[model samples]
Target: MSTIDAQTDSDATDVASRSNYELIIEPRKGLQLFDWKELVAYRDLFRFLIWRQIKVRYAQSAIGIGWAIIQPLFSMLVFTIIFGNLAKVDSDGAPYALFSLAALLPWTYFSNAITDGVQSLVSEANMLRKIYFPRLMLPLSAVAAKLVDFGIAAVMMVVMMIVFQYPPSIQIVALPLAIIVMLITASGVSVWLTALAVQYRDIKHGMNFLVQLLMYASPVVYAASIIPEKYRLLYAINPMVGVIESFRAAILGTTSIPWDLLGVGFLSGTILLITGLAFFRSKEKIFADVA
Candidate 1:
């Protein structure tokens, strides 16, 4: 081979070596889209994020996990006294405490999930600015971590059921559906608010009032049957109305599973979730900047 040709070949090899190790960091092209597959691929990171939240939740607490049962348990007591006794609200023939608790358990989960999930990104601004993971994980994991609280509270529920002699009926088979509805609804609202929260901080302040209004709007303290039949269908559109009522039927067997409510709630939840995901994806590009 000619000397010049040999020299040129070495130069080409050197350039090829440099090219092999090069990494081009550039902006993502065009409009961003939610990558569902990327989320699945990062499942380990998601689990870790959930665990990290769980640790942070109980790290400095004295009662620790007991705090989970406290809220619903106390709420049940208050509602039992106010609605069950004072106003004489009907509990579908179920004991008022059991009646209120069944609703409180799922309701508490939904409320806490939204409260935590909405503020998750803002609370973790440093992490948001420093790293690249699925931004959805922040809200998603915040929701998941609350499952720990839900589980602890559920055990307390089993004890209450035993004391009250309220064995869940065969309709308990439908309880999973109620849980799914709760998750879908909470996640949807949280994602939408978390996305918007990165832009507008006012949501956090109004959230508690909104949650209280939602609780009362549903049959949490009263009977769904008491609502004029004409408005029941529209009332079920609130998402919690169906799930809260379903929790009662599935657990207390006070009434047949309200398939209509489930159908309505599930449909509304799906729309909220799909639209929320779209909004989150569109605004994702600005999260690090705003957060």
Candidate 2:
């Protein structure tokens, strides 16, 4: 009987060891990262979120999508007055209104994405508590939905170029890359803002101020050529500098590629994108509860 009992105990211990080895070990809290596969699994939800955001934005608005054109047109007039006439800001020899409008197109998309994306989770807290989907989807959808507005603004840019009798330069080929940088930057900022906004409601109030400050700091009204060569590289760290400058370079045929601007913008955009995604994923688990 002792021999049989010993053999049975050895068998039980072996089974337990096997079970332990088979069990999947998940990381502890705060170490979690984005799960791309899970997001892919919920792809339909992502589409629905994008559609929902679009519908919500335009449903009751009187001007509807027309606001996209009007916003840039009004901004162009203001910039033409303040920057062109009052401040005597140079537009690289192009019309001040056209130059400002070209820059404003991408900038508007980015600004709106940050503003709307930050509030997305808080605004949809009820849906969050009731259902389980990738929380990142909220901000991502908000940014994507705004692309329609960007498209409209882009169309307006083309029209303005034609109206000004501006012909496309060979460098126009680079415009796609420029727009990609804008998207990445916008999404990156959205990630950070969304994560931070969840915990600090103060972000809601300060976000507008920060964006306005950023706009002035960017070369939106003035030409990038006006900045001193020594400071240009440092200034390019603001990704918008590269974007606005490059757009002008492409459309107006005035400046070069702004390689220095491109370098800083690309590096900063990449770093922000990585860090922002990590930050968003780290806190996503608690978003439903706190938002």
Candidate 1: residue 225 Cα off by (Å): 1.0
Q: What TM-score does prediction 1 earn?
A: 0.91
Best by the TM-score measure: 1
Which regions of candidate 1 deviate over 4 angstroms?
1-16, 19-33
lDDT, candidate 1, 1-291, per-residue tens: 999999999999999999899677876667554677889999999999999989988899999888898999999999999989999999889999999999999999999999999899999899889989899999999988999999998999899999987788999999999999999999999999999888999998889998998888988898789988899899999888899989999999999999899889999998888899889988888999998
Highest-lDDT candidate: 1
Q: Over the stretch 1-291, how does candidate 2's per-residue lDDT look in tens digits?
A: 699999999999999988887567565466445778989999999999999998988899999999888888899999899989999887887888888987898889989999999999999999989987889899999999999999999898888888888887899888888888898888899999999999999999899899999998988888878888899889998888898888888777787777679778988987888999989887877888888
TM-score of 2: 0.88
Local distance difference test scores for all models: 0.91, 0.87
Range of the 10 consecutive residues with the lowest summed lDDT in candidate 1? 27-36
Which segments of model 2 are wrong by more than 4 Å?
1-32
Report how far off residue 138 is in candidate 1 (Å).
Answer: 0.6
Task: lDDT for model 2, please.
Answer: 0.87
